[model samples]
Target: MISEGRYKNQKAIIVENENLSMSFLPDTGANLASVVLKEENFEFMVQRPEREYRRVEFGGDYVEAECSGMDDMFPTIDRCYYERFPWSGTELADHGEVWNLAADVNVKGDDRVDFTFHGVRLPYVFHKNVSIIEKNTVRIDYSAENNTDFEMDFLWAGHTMLQAEPGTRVIVPEDCTCAQAVFTDSGRIGAYGEEFDYPVYRDKDGSLRDMSVMGERQKDSEKYYLKYPLTEGMCGIERTNGRSFTYRFPADRVPYLGLLQNFGGFREMYNMFLEPCTSPFDRPDVARLMKKNCVIPPRSAYDWYLEITVR
Candidate 1:
């Protein structure tokens, strides 16, 4: 059965069943909001304004994105302006042809809660399923569906923001590396240098001590394809004083990942963003070049999935 509850002054919904026990924040402006699995003590916060927005936070565990929410230029959080369909209401549905979508919530079991949404024109749909089992570990599944006339341009980029403190180190698989940092504007020093082969290193002072100069790679500006190969399926950020939370994505389904950090400010400060994107930003042209962007066949459906397991 589904029930209503409250936590930290936020309104929430609870779902319970034999296999799962889930919780959700219905009043928040987040797409999927908060979720907890029955078998685990770990809870997943999809969009918590208290911590930040457009970013997911794993409580007592780890923070996900770097600079989440609408870009500083666009501060409203009503709907995702970039989404093919944007919905501001509490229900999910097909708004129309002009990029309108909805956020829908459902209870499948006594302890399981599911959040679903659809993007028209764009060959993709988002589904987040959370189940609480028993070991304080919550099972989270994030899936995207393709629903278009032809294979469509696709990217599952998540903007997660982490709180900054000393001794924080961003980690990735030994085999995987980061592309050089791209500056949104010119004149300022970029976060990481121009090399795309090695992991970007940072010291406690938050300086790019390894590389003297930043490299210029306009792939996203030209066509948008930011991806790093992950054969092991796991990477993470660790805080020397606190705990480390490993971020995992299925390698078979998601082959590309992006890491961003905004410390001090967009110009300077200390923050890290770990993104898993199916395609790069604003590179519709590259999608055609690489044939990486998907096109949904007329009236057909395509589905994909990702999960976050905290320990």
Candidate 2:
């Protein structure tokens, strides 16, 4: 069922069924604040320590706000200037625009909530529908329209940060044998742009690291991009408690995948981000420079869907 609830002083829209329940704060970037597996009575989202939500500026830093759960990373992932003609040098927000603006929410009975957001700086409209489609499945349908005549390069990532433990392991397609190190905080893996064997990785000093499994809080964090489009388009995490959540998407629509490991590195938190995205990497300008970013046609719309099965 869908209900209006107050979560730690923030306006929350909760949609649930018999198996899963999701609570998202529409006022705070429409953040998916909570995801509970009903059978296990377990929370999947990484809990934010902040009790209250505060409004963020149009181009403010994302870290300054409540850094929790899933925040829609759109148009771009990192702070960069629009590189195309006419819009060149236009500064994009740190984690895109939607995360800072309030979304107009529409609740449909007990199973669906649709959020619509008109862009403040960019010329586009974004829509996301969060719904419970089955007892063990949650579905999210996403779409965006380019309101301008000029085509624009963009990237969209499903930035879901889940609570993780040492024994948790990440699951991907068998063919995704390697990944590129896109970003690193402590250089625990290798430098940026370096590619390594997946699951079983040999680090710089020849340390055999099973990258699929989580280790201790090593004060390090890194983001990895699958070198190629995932034809299978599947990713998930197996928790230590025997609860596993799997994500499935269309390979043609959301073909790229990224994995973020935050092992007591940034903000001293332990979590994991299994990002299913459009582009192979972050930063729209960089992706555009590499001729890999997706572009919405002039006056046209783009659409995709993400399905999650928790068991």
Candidate 3:
């Protein structure tokens, strides 16, 4: 049923059933605040303690907001120049403009909830629907429609930052391949642009590091983007306590998978993200430069969906 709950100081809508439950905050970028597996008593998404939502400054500065929950990163992830100045000539608000703007929640109940946001900086409307499909499963469907006369380039990703314990490990499909490192600024144990089989990576110091398990490590962060046309559209985290959370999607629609591990590197908390993306790169300009940005035709709509399950 749909009811009001407190997400820190913000109000959130709670939707649930006998097996699973979810919370969403419309004011704070329509963030999926929490996903709970009732039987297992596990919370899949992370929540940054003592964080408050604030407007993201014009240049993608993300210091004002919390890093928890599942947020939609769209339009542009990195800073890019807009030919037209709706406000500023640059389109860069850290993860994107969608995360700060308030979204309208139109439907809410035990089975499904639909929310939508209209972009102020870009000419498009985004819609997302979350539904309970099975006892241990939930599906999230997304669509973006261009409202402008010209084509636009953008990036989209499921910023699913998950909770992890010391013995937790991320599992990718057997045939999945990824780069040694993607986010260069986040510090890396390996060289940039080197290709590696999933899980095992070759560090720059000629050392082999296993990327799967979240062992006891110092302050360090690593990120990698899965190459286009993935062999399989599935990945998950198996907790040390024996619980598992998995995400499945259409490989053709979601072409990229990203692994983000921050082991006390950026903050005091240790968290991991198994991101499914429509585009490969995080930087909008870089993605555009590398021809990896998604192009939406004028007056057209794009749609896709993914499923999350616990077992």
Candidate 4:
């Protein structure tokens, strides 16, 4: 069932089952504020310990808030002006347009909740539904419809940041052996726009690094996308205690996967993001130039889904 709750001192709406519990901040960015795996007595989502939520404007920085749980990144993830005519030069927010705004909530009353947000600056409506479809599985479905007569270009990624600790192992398809670097905070990787070996890499200091295993808190951070679409369409992290959770999606629909490994570099927090996006680039403008933007045709909608299962 769904009820009122609080996450990080912000007002929240909660949806729970006997095995799992999810907290949401419907009015503040339609965020999935928290996720708890009841069987493991674990808080699945990262909680930036001791940080309070900060109020922000439409064009404000996403980092200004308690950067935890899941925030819907729509239309664009990075702030950039619209790339096409009719809306060119229209600036999108730092982390898309939906965050930090009140969303209309529709409770489905069966361990499910729906949130709808109309673009404040663009021409579309975004809808996301959270469902506890199985005892230990949470499913999220998303659809965005173009409201204008002309087709539109957009990107939607669920920015779910999971709690990380030393020794946690990231699981990808066994045959996948490479990653394309998009962002990195250290010289361990070859900086941005580079391709590197998967899970193992030689550090700048000439040390062999296991990229898949989470390490202790430090100033190091790295992010990359799977160089190619997964043949199996799944990824997960096996925890120190052997308990784990995996995300499954259709590879053809959401062909790109991003890993945001932040041991401590960004805000001194330990967390990692499993980003299933439509494009490899975080900036839509850049993605458009790279011919990777997903589009919704006039009077139509595009859809995708994600599922998380815990062991």
Better of 1 and 2 by lDDT: 2
TM-score for each predicted model, relative to the true structure? 0.60, 0.96, 0.90, 0.94
Q: Kindly list the per-residue Cα lDDT of model 1 for residues 10-90, writing each as its tens digit.
A: 455664454344445443322233334444543333224453333232111112232232111101111223323322222
Residue 168 accuracy (lDDT) in model 2? 94
- As a whole number from 0 to 100, the lDDT of residue 141 in candidate 3 is 90
Using TM-score as the measure, which candidate wins? 2
lDDT-wise, the better of 2 and 3 is: 2
Q: Higher TM-score: candidate 2 or 4?
A: 2
lDDT of 2 by residue, 83-194 (tens): 8876888888888887777889998876789999887667889998988888888888999899788997889998889999898999999888888898888776678778
**Deviation (Å) of 107 in candidate 4:** 1.2
Error of 4 at 196 (Å): 0.9
lDDT tens digits, residue span 192-294, model 3 = 5556766777666767778788866567777787665576888899998888889999888877788888787766678888888888767655666667667
Selected candidate, larger lDDT, 3 vs 4: 4
Per-residue alpha-carbon lDDT of candidate 4 for residues 143-170, written as tens digits (9 for 90 to 100) = 8888788878788777888887899999
- The regions of model 1 sitting more than 4 angstroms off are 1-3, 6-10, 13-102, 120-125, 133-136, 184-194, 200-227, 267-270, 282-287, 290-292, 295-300
- Backbone clashes in candidate 1 total 53
lDDT of each: 0.42, 0.85, 0.76, 0.82
Top model number, lDDT: 2
- The TM-score obtained by model 3 is 0.90
Ordered from best to worst lDDT, the candidate numbers read 2, 4, 3, 1
lDDT of 3 at 293: 65
